[model samples]
Target: MGFNPKDAIESVKDIATNAVERSADIVESAGYIIKGDVSDGVVGIVSSSMDIATHSVEKIKEIATGRDEDVDEIGG
Candidate 1:
């Protein structure tokens, strides 16, 4: 099939998610925080991917759950 942006996004999202989860596991095993502030630490682990899929998911949940009024940025 031709290139698919959705598939690309999903793959990056999975990668970021794995990084976050793996980092969390490491933190839990060591009984200490990963690095920096908790929120930044998690994002830092995923930042290398240069994809916003995870953040978009978070923003959507924030809006849907009423945790925030809207996404930090509109749709890509």
Candidate 2:
């Protein structure tokens, strides 16, 4: 078979374009595609912070309503 130079160049261009399209599809499907495992870290930190804040609020309430002593001063 005889090879045509123009056809070869067009084939190469098609391949490059196809590769680029496939790559774009993969990237778009994967979402933002940032540099780190940001999900695990952000979720863990937010959840742990919420837990700590809840516990602290409970502690403050308990202190504001002391069992042994009258909390007259602490009451609003």
Candidate 3:
């Protein structure tokens, strides 16, 4: 076997290219996963905020009307 510099350089280039391509694919997949997780988290926060808003409004209404019925209903 002969130590050919040209062949060694070509082989190194090919390996580096393959490694870069594989790394890019992994990074792309991870980006998609992170995006999905952020989307789900935003939806959860929005849903919780809406629920809190509705409950607050209901409580205010009950207090303004001096209603004991709502509290009694919950206790029952």
Candidate 4:
């Protein structure tokens, strides 16, 4: 029987994908597009690093407490 190159390539791809997903530090891997008018306007984008450990916990508390007013104070 002849050797199949296609199967070998697929196996390698699967291994690489698995390795990437197994890492703990990877939170999300997605792209987002911001569509808006920036003509003659100043646009600012803010972001927080993944190292903020308490951020997730605080958000959970805000949700559970059901405080819309405090939501703005948290990070909104």
Clashing pairs in 3: none
The lDDT leader among the candidates is 3
Q: What lDDT is reached at residue 52 by model 3?
A: 50
Q: TM-score, each model?
A: 0.36, 0.41, 0.41, 0.28
Using alpha carbons, what is the TM-score of model 1? 0.36
lDDT per residue as tens, model 2, 1-76 = 2345555555556555555655554454345335465675455555545555554454444444433233454464
Higher-ranked by lDDT: 3 or 4? 3
Q: After superposition, how far is residue 64 of candidate 2 from its true place, in Å?
A: 0.2
Candidate 3: worst-modelled 10 consecutive residues by lDDT: 60-69
Q: Report, for all candidates in order, the number of backbone clashes.
A: 0, 0, 0, 0
RMSD of candidate 1 to the truth, in angstroms, is 10.4
User: Alpha carbon lDDT of residue 42, candidate 4?
Assistant: 22
Tens digits of per-residue lDDT, candidate 1, 1-76, equal 2345565566557656766766655555344234336665455545533334555565445534444334444443
- lDDT by residue for model 3 over 5-74, one digit each (tens)? 5655554565555556555555555565577866655555555455555555554445544452454465
Candidate 4's displacement at residue 21, Å, is 0.4
RMSD of 2: 29.9
Q: Scored by CA lDDT, what does every candidate get?
A: 0.51, 0.49, 0.53, 0.37
Q: Tell me the spans in candidate 4 whose CA falls farther than 4 Å from its real position.
A: 25-76
Local error of candidate 1 at residue 27 (angstroms): 0.9
As for TM-score, the candidate ahead, 1 or 3, is: 3
Q: Which ten residues in a row have the lowest lDDT in candidate 2?
A: 61-70
In candidate 2, which residue pairs clash?
A: none
Between candidates 2 and 3, which one is better according to lDDT?
3
Which residue pairs overlap in candidate 1's backbone? none
